[model samples]
Each structure stands twice: as C-alpha cells, then as structure tokens.
Target: MFVSRLLDFQKTRYARFMNHRVPSNCRYQPTEYEHAANCATHAFWILPSILGSSILYILSDDQWETISAWIYGFGLSSLFIVSTIFHTISWKKRHLRTVEHCLHMFDRMVIYFFIAASYAPWLNLRELGPWASHMRWIIWIMASVGTVYVFFFHERSFGGRDAGAGMREQGRAAMTCFFHMVAPNGKQKAPGVSPKPQTPDSELAAPRPG
Candidate 1:
C-alpha cells in the first residue's frame, strides 16, 4: 500500500509539471528556447556545486576572498552570456512578456545559486571563527529571498488571447503553405482558413420563408 501511494504521488507530481501550460505569449526560438529550458529545468541546481567544487580543487589556496572572487566572476560571466543570447533572440522574435519574465526568473535563480554556494564554504571554514557563525545565516537568508522571488515571479499567459497566439497563427499559416508546396491537394490548411463546414438543412434549423 505504501509503495502504491508513493507511486501515485509521483504520478501526480509529474502531471503537475507537465500540465503547467507555458504561457501562450511565449515565442520559442528553437536554440535559445532549449538553452533556457535546460538551464532552468536541469542545470541550474547542479552546475553551481560542480563548478564551485572544481574551482576549489584546482586552486592551490583555499582562501575565501580569492576563491569567492573567482567564483563570482565566473558565475556572472556565464550567466550574463546566457542572458544576453536569450534576450537577444527573444527580442528579435518579439516573444511575449511572459516568456521574457520567465527567462529572467531562470537567470536570476541560477545566479542566486551560484552566488550562495560560492560563499557557503566560507560559512563553514574553521579558521573564520566568529565570522563563520554569521555566514550560514547570510547564505540562508539570501537563498530564501531568491526562492521567494522566483516563486512569486513565475507567470505566463496561455489560451487564445495571449500575445504569442498571433505567432502560432502565423506558424499554422506557414505549415499550410508548406503542405501546399509539397502536396497541392493537401487538406492541411489552418482550420478556420479552410472552408466552413457545411451541413444539411435538416441538421440545422431552416430559415423561415421570406
């Protein structure tokens, strides 16, 4: 029974993740779109620890100041590059505000994690003594604040009225054109762009004679 309940809970969580509709206003460029998603959905949580630990191992000295500076610079540069690429493509594509907002949230969260982890070791170093005591609190506070912001900032538009719906409509138009190019008789035109459905008068109420 316990195993069954756990499986049920996992199914429910997966459903929630999958069903969360990306706001319709978002226009997705295939490249940057995938990059942003990979960063947010997978790498954001893992990369910081990996990079930070690697940096620590490579450095000859374990001094907090030097390590922190290197980590900060590396973190900022990496995030800035990603943000720049994502924003540039998004702007050119005229993506919806919701997409832009979501991207920003993703970037901020990654940066937040990087910054927090970079200082975490300092909070634990024995030599730091009294200062180390406050380090934990500071890191916790910063992380807490960032998490709250990300949760509150996550917003997206969906459905027919969203800004990106026009782009989707255009995509539908292009797909129809492509179909026509490959197969002149193809019936794959946009739904409403095609002829209206016809029904027998018996299937509808007949108009009264004038």
Candidate 2:
C-alpha cells in the first residue's frame, strides 16, 4: 500500500513537470524507439544526394562550375548528416544525456557552417555579374559573424536563457537575395503586378475589349 502511494506520487510529480513550460531545445523528442528511427530517416534522405552529387561533381567537364555545385550540395547534406548523428545518440543511458545536449548545440553550429557554405560558391561564379566580387566578401564576413552569434545563442537558449535578441541575422539578407535570384520570375513582372500575376477570372469570362 505504501509502495503504491509512492508510485502515484512520483507519477504526479512527473505529470506536473511535463505540463510545465519548457524550452523547445530542452524538450528533445529522442525518447527510445524514435532515436534510431530519426537517424535512419535523415540518413536515407541525405545519403542519395551526397552520393549522386559527388559522382556528378566528379564527372562534370567544367571543374569550375562543379566546385560551386558541390559546395551547394555538400553544405545542405552535412546538416542532414550532423542531425542524424545527433539524434541517433540517445540519452537513455543517463550518463550520455549531457553529451547528447552538447551534440545538440554542435548540430546548431553546423547549421551556421552550412548556411555559409551554401553562399560561398556563388561569390566566385562569374555569371553572378559585377557585384559578385563585393557580395562574396560581404557574405563571408556575415557568415563568420552569424556563426559565432548562433553558436552562443543556441548555448544560452538551451540553458534556458532567453537572450536571443538577434540570433543569426547576418548573411540572411544575402541568402534571401541569392534565393530570389535563383527562383523563377524573381523580378517584378510589371509595375503593380504580383510576381505570379493572374488576370481576373471575370475578365476571362467576359469578352475581351480587343
């Protein structure tokens, strides 16, 4: 009877703790069965890109272009690899929980590297035009700054300190510009028209003035 009451007390305490607010990073979902599954899922997603891109990069006739391609491919791939490894390292062993938390921060650090790597190649590409040289220097500088900022931010954020006023803002504008440049119809189609301008359905239904 005493044991049952103690068990109930423990359960109640756990329930209360879980119901209480916790930081997102602290609330990791690496509970048992999902640990290996998380790793496997990410591995399967990343491995093919790594293998296929590596082969393509090796065979590309223009080594110069391939360099940039490889950078883009590998930067994103490494994140998957790092995340897979971090998640795979379960904290069920109790002693490893501290290590797992450390790895979580390490994973965030890699994100900074990946973000930088993704843009580093575009800096050297001649096709990017006159501003390419200038943007390259700017990107590298911001990346360096963002990396340091993000690493420290994640550390404090994980420690339950909400001091992330400007967590990893550097290089973001450049990255956004790069993405827009690559996207279809990145420019304004016409003044006052949306990027994906669709004429009114009513106009289509009615006879054209022309």
Candidate 3:
C-alpha cells in the first residue's frame, strides 16, 4: 500500500515537471555555418535543373548564341563540386549528416530527370518538336514543387542542437576515459586489454571550498 502511493506521487511529480513551459527566447538557434549548410542543400535541389534548362535552351535554339556551351559546362560542374565540399566539411567537423538523406536521394532522382531533359535533345540531334517540349515543361513543374516540400521537411527534422549535442557527447566520453582510474560505470574488462590512461587532474585533487 505504501509503495503504491509513493509510485503514484512520483508519477504525478514527473507529469507536472514535463508540463512546465520553456521560454521562446531560450530556444536554441542554428550556427551560421549550419544555417548556410541548410540553405546550400535547398539551393542544390534547384541548381541541376536550372543548369540543365540553360543547356537545353542553348542546344535547342540554333539562334541562341549568346551563352557559351563551355561556360555552362564549367558552371554546372562547379556547383556539384561545391556541394561535395560542403558535405565533406559538415561530415568531418560536425559529424552531422544532412536531415533528409532520403529526400536528398529523391532530389538526386530529379537530377537525373533534369540531366535527361538536357541531354535528350542533343542525343537524338533532331528537333524536340511538340512532344519533347511538353515533357520538359512537366519535369520543370514537378521539380519546383518537390524542392519546396523537401526543403521544408528537412528544416523541421534537423536543428542546430542536433549538431552541437553530438559533438558535446563525444567530448564528454573522451573526458571520462581520461579522468577515472577505473571504468566510469561499466564492468572491468579482461586482463589482456589495457584501460585508457587516466589524466592527473581527475585523480586525488583536493576540492576547493565553495
């Protein structure tokens, strides 16, 4: 009877605590790099399509001589190259994967569509005529719609705290290994496997009075 009442009390206390409100201003915000990374990811979704359109335009219209093919090729390749750099930097420093790996995967599918749209004209080397123009228009419309949803979903799934917390936890684990003479909490390992060396500051240092 006593134990049941104690359990009920604990449950109620927890419920009350959980219901407490957090201040809006206290909410965590993304770091500038993280924000930039998010913006880049969204921008990337549209870029291939945009480049492909330009390439298609140059190829389709014989009179479209203003834009150089070499310039378009160089620019298109550079955008993808820059995106790779962003992914590499984010992975190494933050250990943060982009939020929508699946959506990004989907975006890649759209990229192929754009590439095909661009390449189809040149490949057949015949006029796209009526049918091909309609297909290209359809691809553009679908890509624009998909990009909006994917970007919105990604922003909601990932936040700055996710990146910060991941790095912080790693640092904590390393600190634990360097400090305690024994395993922090877990059972001792076998004789052959040596434990990590403990640092001096973690041992026997007299605590200063508060």
Candidate 4:
C-alpha cells in the first residue's frame, strides 16, 4: 500500500511538471521545487568552474595571460555564484522582496561582464591585426555601457516586456558578439603560403614568439 501511494505521488508530481506553462508576463513565480531546481543548476557548477579557472590561471605563461585568465575566471565563477545565491534566496526567502529585487538586478548586471570576460582570453592571447586589437578594448567598453544600462534603465525599460522581447534581446546580443568575433581582420596571406592550423586551445592560449 505504501509503495502504491508513493507511485501515485510521483505520477502527480510528474503531471504538474509536464503541465507547467510559462506566463505571458515577464514575472515568473516558480514553485518552491522549481526554484530549488533552478538554484541547483547553477550551484552545482560553481565548484567545477572555480577549479577550472584556477587551472587556467596556473597554466598562464605571462603577466597579461594571467590577467586575462583571472578576468575570465572571476566572470565565470561570479556568474554561477550570484545566480545560485539569487535563486536560493528566491526559493527560501520569497517574502524578502527588497533583498530579492537587489539580487535580481545584480544577477542581470553580472551577465554583461561575463560576456566580455568570455572574449578576453581569445582577444588578448591571439595574434591579430590592428582591427582585432582595437576590439580588445572596445569589447570592455561595450560591456561597461551594457552594465550601466542595466543598472540605470533595466527596470524602467524592460520591467513590462514579455518573454519574447527578452528572448529577442538575448538573440541580438549574441549575434553582435558573434559577428565581432568572426569579423575579418583585413589580412591576406601570401600566395602559396599555408596558414597554421588552429585548435580551440590555441585560440585561447597566448601567442608564442616567432
């Protein structure tokens, strides 16, 4: 009888999960279990991300490389940490509106920094022409502008937007970064000269002296 009752409960929980629908408005009030699950998604990665960042920092060969690694590491780890904290608070302390709102704002702000840091290693470590070099600094400037926008205008601008608008914003940002990263550097190889093959690691590693 106990086993049968447990099976029925499991079926009911599964049904609720399957029937869940996202509201039209941007405000999503997840159930306690959903909030815990969301928190776990980011919290579980915090340790591994930190360990990976530490490894990259230790593997860095120069001062600039170390700095890039540190930037990337901080961005990656902070994203997860902040997300975990925010979601945990949302789950465990739903009544704390003021604290939750502050954390929520911080959570959004960190994402811009994280995006810029993701590009840092590749931009700083790779050998590039003048255009790409300029982008190295430009990306940070863009991130700063984005962070400022989020801080000063996010609530006022996007507080009433629907889920689709939020998705479109994310898509636009991703496309912008993609084009910047893949844009031509205006360098042409000599006739009959083969370019060196590039691996993922090579793209992020500091350029070796020729």
Candidate 5:
C-alpha cells in the first residue's frame, strides 16, 4: 500500500539523520530530529509572544507601566526570536562553526535579560516596602553582571560541564529571589498581570566547544 511505502521512507530518513556522528570539537551535537524540533518549538511561539507583548504595551495606563511593558515585550520577543534563529542555524548550517559559536553565546546571554524583563512589571508596579524597593535596581544589576559573566567566563573559567551547572544555579537563585520578593506575604500578588518566568527548552540544546 502507499501508506506502507511512506512509513518505510520515513524510517529510512530518520535512520540517515540519526546516523550522523557528533563533531569532535562539539560538547554535544543533537540528532537531526532534535534540531528540527527545537527550531520548530521556538519558531512557533515567536509571533504569539510578540503579539501578546504588544497587547500588554497597548494596555498600559501610564509612563512607568509603558516602560515596563516595553522592557518585558522586548525581552519576550527577543528570547523566542533569538532561540529560533539559533536552532534553525544549528539544524541547517551546522558546518558554519564560527557563526554557530557566536549565536550560541548570544542565545545564552538573552536568558539573563529575559529574567529581568519578566520581573519588570511587578517590581515597577507594586509596593514591596523600603528594603524590597531596591530590588528593582538590584535585579537589573544582577542581570548585567550575569551577562558579563556569560560573555567573558562562561566556558573559560570552568570546564564545559561544570559551567552549565553553575549557570543553572545562578538562574535558580535569581528566580528564587524574585519569587520571594513578589510574595513576601506568602500569596500570589499580581495574578494575571505579571508574566510568569519562562525557561526555554532550547536552553539545554548543545553548543559547540569553543
């Protein structure tokens, strides 16, 4: 039957894609199926994320709100956009080591900005007491420091394996602080107003060893 022939063809293609060997210089290389899935997952969300951010920006009632909206929107869109491009390149142009390496670093860097942006609306809009008020500036400073660290010391200071664990711990600590401040009274404050933190699955996608 035609359906049987189609299934056999698919199996052949899958085997061919999966049989490719990981390059020696790369820490990890995804199978073709993984590359395609990662690219699709992030690409699919790009437009919706942008549209949602635009809606939030339009709904803002004041200057501070508008600024927060803009920050959050840019962060949200860039996260998806950069992720999609990176994965697409990874899948389609794996041979371009230099270009892939640069994008891989950039992809990692965007997560810090996204974290700060996720908290922007809440930190700017709510009153979290005098001590907590400083968190608004503190979060950004932390993000900036994180960016610099990723740029200069990511895989350089520690070997590739440990560096990832350290980055994850740092991200976890940052989120923990954000949640603690957001809910000092032990109740969710903003409900639908504040965007929930996002962890892109592509964050774990393998990068070439530099």
Candidate 6:
C-alpha cells in the first residue's frame, strides 16, 4: 500500500506538489510533499544499515562488538523503515487519525527500545574502566521505564497538548545522556558523582615517558 504510493508519488508530478490532505498530527504538516520527503529520508537508512552489517560481518567473526554491530544495523534499519511507513500511513489515512496516531506511537516505542539495544554491545563491551559494567544496564533500565510509560500513556501523549513532542524530546535527551556519558572517547567525567580514578587497566595502558 504505502510502498506503492511512495513509488507512484515519485512518478506523478501532481502528487509531488504541496497540499493539505494529511492528518493534523502528522509531522507532515504544512504540505504533503514534506511528509513524503520525511518518509523517504528515513526509509533511505534501510539499505545502508543492511549493507553495513554485511560488510562488518564479513570483516569480523568473533568480536562481540561485531555481533552487536550487526544487531545495531539491522535493528535500527527496521525502526527507520517502519517509522517512515507508518508516518506516511498516518498522513495518508486521514479518516483513521486515532488509529494512525496510535500506530505512530508504536513506531516511536520501537525506537526507544532500539536505542538501548543497539548501544548495548558497542558501549558495554568497550574498556571504559569502571563504567563498562553497568552502562548497558543503565540504558536498558531507562528504556524499560520508557517502554512501560509510553504504552501506558500512549493516548494521552498523542492527544494531550504538548504531550507527544515534549515527552519524546525530553526522554530522548535524557536517555541519550546515559549512553553518551560512558563513551570511550577517553574524556573525563562522572556517572553518579565525581569521576572515579582510572582502574589499573587504564593506568597500565597510559602512555609512558617519550
């Protein structure tokens, strides 16, 4: 259905023009073409993730991050494609606004999970001194809380003023900080309080006098 419309929209010049035939909730507001463009942009991530996974799989066999990297690629690819499809559908099916809005929430719910899942292997497996052990767990904890909250408040978030957009942005920011804090970029920082002294392993790896 949507796949066909996406293809047709490209072929037909008239369909590409701006219009207001979409739902009020669609991020696709102001113009129909903008909606199509957003969907297409997200859908574009699908192929690159697939190809990236295949390439990485061929390059590394036993590395845990390699395995997780594959999972990350495929998992996020699906999230992006699904988001694109339902976002399009939510716009196209103007009459089913309520149902479509719910569908959009489900789409976002997957994203909340995927963010944690995809980051687990990469962030947790790295040698981040003391932080590696629980960084992934912290992310899962946040994701778990988010999943439950999103499901329970699915309607209110969608229907209430400033509900959907506000919560999504704030939650995304807060959850992102959890993983980013543990980034192995070698930056100094704290998780719960002041940064802990580097573990013996970090001390051993420190550069010796030149």
Clashes of each: 2, 0, 0, 0, 0, 0
Q: Tens digit of lDDT per residue, candidate 4, span 123-186?
A: 6665545455576677767667666766675555456753235434543554444334432545
Over 82-193, each residue of candidate 5 has an lDDT whose tens digit, in order, gives 9999998888998998888788888878887888788788777764555666767777786777677777765454454344554565456545445445455555444236
| Residue range 25-91, candidate 3, lDDT tens digits | 3423344555566557755655675676466566643333223244335435544654555444544
Q: Where is model 1 more than 4 Å wrong at Cα? A: 1-56, 60-78, 121-126, 153-210
Residue 79's lDDT in candidate 2:
83
Regions of model 5 farther than 4 Å from truth: 1-26, 156-210
lDDT of each: 0.48, 0.60, 0.43, 0.72, 0.74, 0.63
The true-versus-predicted C-alpha distance at residue 204 of model 4, in Å, is 31
Ranking by TM-score: 5, 4, 6, 2, 1, 3
**Global local distance difference test of model 1:** 0.48
How do the residues 1-210 of candidate 2 rate in per-residue lDDT, one tens digit apiece?
A: 878777663367455332334475666444354565666788887878787668757775555557767876787788898887787675344368777777877776677667666675555443343444366567666656655665567545534543233234544556545533332434322222234567899988998678
- Identify the superior model by lDDT, candidate 1 or candidate 3: 1
lDDT of 2: 0.60
Q: Report the poorest 10 consecutive residues by lDDT, candidate 3.
A: 119-128
TM-score of each: 0.34, 0.57, 0.31, 0.67, 0.68, 0.58
For candidate 6, write residues 128-175 as lDDT tens digits: 455445655666676666666666765444455433464365446444
True-vs-predicted CA distance for residue 74, candidate 2, Å? 3.1
Worst 10 residues of 1 by lDDT: 174-183
Give the C-alpha miss distance for residue 101 in model 1, angstroms.
2.1
- The C-alpha local distance difference test score for the whole of candidate 5 amounts to 0.74
Better of 1 and 3 by TM-score: 1
Off by over 4 Å in 3: 1-61, 64-75, 95-117, 120-125, 155-210
